[model samples]
Target: MSGDGEEDASLEFTPTWIIAIVCTVIIFMSFFFERFLHYIGKVLKRKKNFALFEALLKVQEELMLLGFISLMLSVSQVSLQKTCIKESLMLRGLPCKRESPNSVSHVTFVRHYQTNFPLDFTGMRMLLASESGGSGHCKSMRDWKSWEAKIQQEDDTAEKMVKHVHELQFIKKRFKENKIFSWLHSFGKQFYGTITIDDYRAMRLGFIMMHYKDNPKFNFYKYMIRALETDFKKVVGISWYFWALVIVFLLLNINGWHAYFWISIVPFILLFIVGSKLEHIISNLATKVVDQNAIAIGNCVVIPSDDLFWFKSPKLVLFFIHYILFQNAFDIAYFFWILTTYSFGSCIMGKKAYIIPRLVFSGIIQVVCGYSTLPLYAIVSHMGSRYKKAILPHHMHETFDQWLANAKTNKLKREETSNEGTVDKFWGAWNRKKASNKTEVVAKLEEEMQEVQHEPVPEIEIGIHN
Candidate 1:
């Protein structure tokens, strides 16, 4: 056991630089591409908006893209390694039993998950239920119960109102049903009615195709394009700066520093051009393309306190590592493997394979493994901002600040007008206990008074007879 413990510790501490190298190239290239997007956006907003520097940023963006893609493809040429069971990349898959002298296995999905990954309140159910937390949800059933405790703790009228508001917000954002998942349920309801690692495996584009058989109102292609556009923005928009920081951090643990010197040059140059310029451009573009989604899904009745921002950091961190990293790693691995199963993609499935896998999967692996999680999150911020139109009814929609302010106003009026209900309203157990105690005291006093009122006449008659 001791020997096994030491071995496990050793493996955990061993940094995977190959992952860093791949991610560095993707994000480094993405930074410049996004800068070009920003430039284009700026010119559209107004030509005088940094037109002189546009040529330079464009040239830089182009060069980095070329260099990064070349290097990434080269890395994929490394000696044969085992592919994840979830992935079906031609060079690494089981069908390709023959080992190639030059090929990269990369990290497998199962192996990455074996590492002790973490998540949060929103993500707790999966983690606690994963075989990580013992017998999974079968044992404790803690996920749904955790929220019950939180709700009960909030006793006051105002606090309870806010709690209700936050719950609504949480549902809309965190526990949202996927379009594919919902569509599947609808299809099943139409006929049979039914519902992870093995979930999205065979069905590559999701159950959307099956859904098409039931009802085809939604343009799945348009929906995909929207999702992909958000991903593209994340990989190459103003979000690229976040990607740059991520690249530097990953590169820190890597061995061959000089190989990345040229790569680092452009990100270093990018720092100078960044200011309010890109921010302004992106904001304008967002007003058109993204903010509409935000409006559709904005329902929070409690304005967060300014100090809550600090605490939200940790929550956001857990959310990322859990939902995005863990779930996506498996989902994307499955997606990549399915390419071989696709009608035209069957050529890459079996042995005698000569094809080189694309770095697109490599990029997906890095983010899914929590490498560039923050930056990738920054890029896809808009997608997270919006929800399906049917999610929350318009009447139910209320901003946190709006609801909070209204609650405060009502609370103040009630407090000033009469103090009668304040104790019952705000206090949870203490007020109940107090009311019970008072009732007991009153009943005891009344019993004593009745005894006194009746006892004297009987006693006086007895004394007179004696």
Candidate 2:
């Protein structure tokens, strides 16, 4: 019986090489899948609104990267659990049980058992329950009651911890709701309400470009045009070949032809290299076109040149990096927490098939929520605008003030001219109607109205506005 058990354990254990290969394949598939989606979008001409489509694509790429990272972490944890279990059983001179890496249940088992009852023999017995025992690893059926009771205790403790964390978050929320913070929040809200998210993004991008304006090789307009044009042309030309290769890989994967999957991936690898070369060639051509027609092309797009001084500040750049890092750290932690909780629940419920779908859904929600809150965060934090006046050079500040004053004056002049035109049109229409009857009183009124229209309108000084 012991020999049979050993044989079963050996058969059940997944080889390390297989795990590594599977992980590699998964990562490759994710990359190709994203590329495939972009190709489809291009082929369908869904990129008519280039900026918005590009932003969406960026979010999709980030989500894919996050999922890849999470997968790696989960696999590492599983491998660690497997190693620890095998070592523990070997040291105790016990027969190895059936070990498999098909589920993430070991994460919960290892966390609870290893941390709380490291020296307890029964903890090891319970952990072995995660190994292919179908929830009955103990010697007798009576121990099942004890197992349930212990698990319930652990769940209760976890719930308490979660509740404590929520309380802290509540306190933080209340602090933000205080008078001063609330006032600042409202101010930021108003500022952002005046400028849309897309406009804000464009402003930031323009700032970046202006900061690098001194670099001869970095023309923002040319680079943008090149990227857009290159992607479109490349997608149209190579999409069919890319999809065909992907389909071949999929067929191999589905048919259980594992060895052929690697062979099939070779074609994709070659195609990627060739496509990249083609893209570079196309980009060069597009850049030349942009250079030759710089003025005409530049006129078609609104390039943000104002507030360039604000973005060029080194401190502002550092702060932007800091905020982005902090946001990403929080996002990563939240993603892992969701996965861990989902894994724990799924283990108890004995449903493991939903992990992938849950992961994808969670990623989408995280991306959406992150983007939706980013504008608010930037506004409330007063991220880059707070120190603009203090950090700006004296010359630049003066220049901006002068430009602003001129703009206000021009705007007022235009408004006055428009108002005068309206009066002239109204009087001219009345005079034309009366001229048909040759009324002397109407003719006298027209002369007076023409004199009033000719007089200069008083200029009311416009106040400074944001």
Best by TM-score: 2
Instruction: Please list the C-alpha lDDT of all candidates, in the order they appear.
Output: 0.34, 0.37
- Model 2: residue 407 alpha-carbon error in angstroms: 40
lDDT of 2 by residue, 293-356 (tens): 3333111111332132234342432233222222223223333443454554423212334334
CA shift of 210, model 2, Å: 13
- Worst 10-residue lDDT window for candidate 1 reads 193-202
TM-score of each: 0.20, 0.23
* Candidate 1 accuracy as TM-score: 0.20
Model 1 ranges with Cα > 4 A deviation: 1-39, 42-66, 71-303, 306-311, 314-466
How far does residue 6 in candidate 2 sit from its true spot (Å)? 14
Give per-residue CA lDDT, model 1, range 1-466, as digits (tens): 2455546556365457856887899899888867775766677447432222343354345445546755664465333233334344432423223345345434433323222121111122222122111221221223223433443354433422223322342223222135455333322222110101111111111222233334323333233323323332222222244336434533332223322233333322332122112222122222332222333222221111112222424234323233333332332333344353343344222221222232243343332222222322222222222322222222234465579899999998988766756655668578788999999999999999999998866444445553
